[model samples]
Target chain A: MNALLEISGLTKRFGGLTALSDVSFGASEGAITGLIGPNGAGKTTCFNLITGTLPATSGTIRFRGQDIGGLSPHKVVEHGLARTFQAATTFPAATVRENILRGALLRHPLGLGAMVFGGAAARDAERKARQTVDEVMEALDLTEHAHREAGTLAYGHQKRLGVAIGLATRPGLLLLDEPAAGLNPDEVDRFATMLKEIRTRFGLSVLIVEHHMRLIMRICDHIVVLDHGEKIAEGAPEAVRDDPKVIEAYLGADHAK
Target chain B: MSMSATSSAPAFQPMTVVWIAGIVLAALIPWFTGSVFHFHIAIMVCISAMATGGLAVIAWVGQLSLAHAAFAGIGAYTSVLLVTRLDVPVLLGLPAGALVAGAVAFIIGAPLLRLRGVYFVLITFALNELFRLIMLDIPEFSGGSSGIAGIPKISLFGVTLSNYQSVYPFALFCLALVMGLLVLIRRGQLGRRFAAVEENLALAESSGIPTAKTQTIAFTIGSAIAGFSGAFLAHYVGFISPETFGFQLSVSYVIMLVTGGRLALWGPLVGALFLTPLPEFLRGAVEYQHVIYGVVLIAVLRFLPRGLAGLPRQLSRKGGRG
Candidate 1:
């Protein structure tokens, strides 16, 4: 499969400390790619760099054959990329449907005129936004909480809502930051199945930062491991699982048993 | 999911009736009162409310602008210059002022909007002071300390508005137009986008929303409305002065919005209506009026955080259980 998003020689530095150093990876089109590591392994930092929330000290990020390095976060998303936060952050005062609708409305390019006027073009845009919200909420199993304030949602549902919000943006590549971090075992299993189903159904490329090893291993077609801001190992999930570098960096020496 | 609630249209309700009645009463104030001072107060409320409404828009986008009255001053000067120096008609002058103010706001907002929270507020306050000083310092164009006098009365489509009563309807029309636009904005998609940006900038940006542009749009619109109100006030008073739109006036406008409730659509209107005629009612204790105003503002902010518009809802909720 061709790569939808390409990152090469990526590095980020904060003063004397380098958060990421020469990390390289690509999320292939229509596949699930996982970035796995222990705490402070630069998983979240990598996500931030790819999403344009943090400036890269040096390197290139290409999305759909266009250089997107140094672009603003919103501009990055406008280029067919969307992301969820490590924590389930949302528009706290807005309803669940409204939160998704805000993302969906970004598809309308005419700005305020298209949003306010009831012209044929504006009406069509509004209809699409409503439809996208409905579909995303239903797909995320959040339709039952559509009208509830986003801040009032149960914990797991907030994570789902975060993913649903990213989905509503209709991105070619979806970046999920620790999506299964706080999910229960059963919920993690369901989330893994859902992620796979979403990849196949939406034909989307997904780059996920996760600590949940079971979910990552069960669903990811390809895996890249990071340790101390460096890529320790990478390959198909099974190959990476047995790699001595990844075992030392992540699974520990006892992982062989 | 309750899809039914999403699909249902808003019903014709008591609030609609109340809104219409309020507008009608505002329009008839001059005719029923038959007093010029009453007309003057009514006109002042209309102007103040328009300014307050503009400030509320800025607040909606998560920025508190003290430069609101500066925009009004810009409008006043633009309109006055067009009429006095260029001899343009008042009808065109009014809109020209709004256009210029909006343009200036858009230019300033592009850079200043990068600063968030208290830093934004401090910069805006400095800008307001700068606007006043510029007006005071420039005598030839801005009329200086003595101010511009003997300004011509406004003529709208052939009829000249010569007195307070004559200008009452026009002011009422301006207020209604400004307030109506604000109401439309609140009900439309713009409101949702503004709320999202206000709630979380990072989340909104990640969702593909251009947050800076949204803030700039709010600032421009709010400034434009304030400018339009200023233009109307200048013509009605038949004078223009630096003191007419000063830092104190900006503070009052902010107070009006906050007292009425910053978030609600009717808050500024309720604030302007309540506060504009208050000094006159407190004629017996004119010395303590400012102190009283401060106390009342503090009390409302502390106790009724939602403002007067929210009072009905709060009351209903309290009475519901009983």
Candidate 2:
């Protein structure tokens, strides 16, 4: 009831190495929550765990206070939690419109007859896809490239399309991993404004993983710092940045530097 | 996928459409051509296209299925067995064969769709051999290696079409229907979803396109087409041997698709049109016709990565840059 998503004592192990252990976090509704850490901080592994790309070794993930652990990846999306990848995951050959339509395929739970023949359910899906396309394209300023192959877009546009695809599933909670990872400063500024507008318009509770200090500090309401697969600090952005453990995790020892 | 044809290759050229039209036209062959014997071979190839279209789906998704021939065999045998044993009408038998084939594909897809890359092709190749063995091992149903003879031709409303006259147009019509369905699948929401799964399963899953479900749909559709073709094929020949839908048939279907280019719908048609006639045309040099065919496909693959339909676009890209 207090959170849209609740994870308790989550553990993930790959053979001898534990990628994540005893990790617990809760995400509230309609707020931008930032998860930040140094490289190899297990930020992505956590994303993987919540999205069910990798099953938890042991733990509980509850969405809307209902246990959703051990669900299939597609079912995770169906539960109204969608995620973007750290690496850009745009389909190279499909046009931007097609790339987005694939996301809209999840909006309905229609069966084979509707899927095959484009019955009323299929037509309804198309209508929704077109509307979502118009909305996201305007939000992300990608309408001009809507018909262009996603791969041919500029690197920054490709990154935005990746986010747009995540947005397409109409997630109650959206997870963005490194949205501004490969963008230039100018593009990052533009992305920040777009990101703000998305939160305002869609009313989505966004859990974004970012390393860019400026973007996170400016946009995140609350911040969680991860250090070597451990939760080192969690607080308001200003407080987390000032925390000693956060500084050490990011900067490492001054002597070593 | 991009609408920027950016080329001067007539009005309708952007790779996928050309192949779609080509395969569709393969079904329309009997309408124009006059020779009854030509109709016989063309109808056979058209049936071959149904199975190949299914293979095209598998290959487009970066999966290879050597047991394509096996599914065709399953379809042919199922319908043959049904017609021979149950006295079911040919119309009923065709769907029956397709249903059995689809069920078999569902079972195969459950296990094989999980394998990675070329591992699937290897597994399918083994399955093709296994199916042939099963056909021979079960003599009562399959008639052993001898196969079932005098399998009834496909008929409608009690009208027997067991000859070249009936089977040729029927095969062509079925081809058209299958191609139409494939085009719709490619153009429709599910079609795009399958392409997405083929292009990137991880991205597809993250985007909420059910990967397993989409793969199953594609496999089921592909298998159904294969089985449907087999039913028509059994009747077209008025007899069937397990050998007809075996390794050589699988190789030919893949060759047709590859020579034509895999994603292009027309690829299989062009492949069948050219390859189906070449050996017969050079009957005197029959010993080396297949070698020539292989050499030609090699040249095409090297030069036109998109297949025959891709040549003009590739040339124009060079021409524009030049």
Best candidate, lDDT: 1
Q: Per-residue lDDT tens digits of candidate 1, residues A107-215? A: 8755677555446776677677888888887778888897799999988889999998899999999999999988899989888878877777667889988888878
List residue ranges in candidate 2 displaced over 4 A.
A253-257, B1-34, B285-290, B315-322
Residue pairs with clashing backbones, model 2: B19-B265, B19-B266
Residue A165, candidate 1: Cα error in Å is 1.3
Off by over 4 Å in 1: A250-257, B1-30, B284-290, B320-322
Instruction: Report lDDT (Cα) of residue B96, candidate 1.
Output: 93
Q: What is the model-wide C-alpha lDDT for candidate 2? A: 0.80
Q: What DockQ does each prediction reach against the true complex?
A: 0.61, 0.47
lDDT per residue (tens digit) for residues A47-114 in model 2? 99999899899989999978888887888998999998877789998888778767866786566766
lDDT of 1 at B29: 71
Question: In model 1 chain A, which range of ten residues has the least summed lDDT?
Answer: A109-118
lDDT of each: 0.86, 0.80
Q: Per-residue lDDT of B191-250 in model 1, one digit per residue for the tens?
A: 767888889989999998888989999999999998998888888888989888888778
